[model samples]
Target: MSIEPAGHGIEADNALDRRFSGRNEAVPDEAHHDGRGRFYWFLIGMRGIFSLPALILMTSYLGFAAFALDVGLTRSEAVFIWALPAQMILVGTMAGGAHLAASFAAVTFSSIRMMPMVASVVPDMRNDKTPTIVLLALSHFIAITSWVFATQRLRHVPRPYRTSYFAGFAITLTSINTAIVGIGYGVVSAFPPVVAGALFMLTPVYFISSIWASARQPVVKIAFLFGIVLGPLFAVIEPQFDILYAGIGGGTVAYAIDRVRRRRHAAGGV
Candidate 1:
């Protein structure tokens, strides 16, 4: 890599991006396109289980095990709903004697945040031979841990191996987490809510850190800022919808601000 004078903030970030984008010339592109290369990267991706985010996620699922037990759900049910927070709401609503339609509506609304996460990561990982079906299949594994893990690492990986790399990491992470829940399922009575709650708290703490590290785009930082400001405010106003409102409202505001900034910069007015 060429050495250059350092820049500040976003300028520094762009410099880093310029430094890494397609710069992995240690192996030729053809090598990565082959079965051997894909397998190698897949194994490399599996190493993500040792990462901090993966560890945090694994720890959090222990809490989820307790939650599942408390809710009278089977071990399999806990693993099923663990990925989608909205489904947890569905369980809670149905437990409260809510109608099926109402429970389904709540799950649908809570799931809206997943759309952007899937959209943002897929294009960057795609190549000429990558099929739409494969991408769609892989989308099921795209969650907070995998998204953050993959986004921060994908730029350095070869285009052809990106999907395999993601699959390795995501599948490994998911499998281990599932195992954690399964093993902890019948043992939740000994775990206690206080212990479980403390363990679950690691997720957001790592989430904020990981998001900040990978948020090179101005919109991402803007959204993070707005989320921080709006989350608690909305929590007090309406706890149930606080997450929905804060996420949508912050992202919308951030997107608008980023769009305006880009336009101004493009027009040479900044």
Candidate 2:
């Protein structure tokens, strides 16, 4: 019912404990106030609609929508493509006259990045008591930003409220993205080409910056670096299959490097 400053939840919880617990009484956990906890976190998630993560997602979808419009896709088609769990590369293929099978393949391949995210995040938020349908449904919301945000913040969130918090965050993010995609498509032609170019460029720039800001693991950093270096080169060599080849080669190289580094460290010298 009330808004607190960011990062104040722990302090507030401590204060609540001091106020509520007597000398002989044990402090109640967050789940003891499950309804309030979920409501509070849900509100927090909804309030974060204007934050950087949402902005990045909105800009990226905007760029995609604009491109789809330019390539003669109808508004409904554009929304349909955006709604699909595919990356922008699949949409690019569609725009470039690729067949249905090729588009599906590219989309599936592009989505492999989501696998690690799913494997890492779901277990943290779930328990044996959690329902199968809940896990299955929430998996759809496990994109890059949501995964990063949830991985960090859910540690502080109560077990019972994590799913509710995430649902609110994901819903707010996707709703804004869906709306912006339509807006971008409608406005792309209304603006000049120079402006349109800048708008479209926002997507890739935001994506790279988001990754650069969030990546901490050595293997991930190395993989991203190799991908950046190899992507253009592979594009030049064979444009059609560039994403697939670059991802495979870059990931392999990074994994090899990481294994070598770990082995050396284990031997007590690196």
lDDT of each: 0.79, 0.69
What TM-score fits each model?
0.82, 0.69
Per-residue lDDT over 163-212 for candidate 2, one digit per residue giving the tens place of the 0 to 100 score: 77788888888887777777778675566778767765765665565555
Predicted candidate 1: what Cα RMSD to the true structure? 4.8
Best by lDDT: 1
TM-score of 1: 0.82
RMSD of each: 4.8, 6.6
lDDT agreement of model 2 with the native? 0.69
Off by over 4 Å in 1: 1-27, 79-84, 192-194, 236-244, 262-270
Please identify model 2 stretches exceeding 4 Å from their true place: 1-30, 84-106, 109-113, 144-160, 183-185, 238-241, 266-270
Error of 1 at 214 (Å): 2.3
- The count of backbone overlaps in candidate 1 is 0
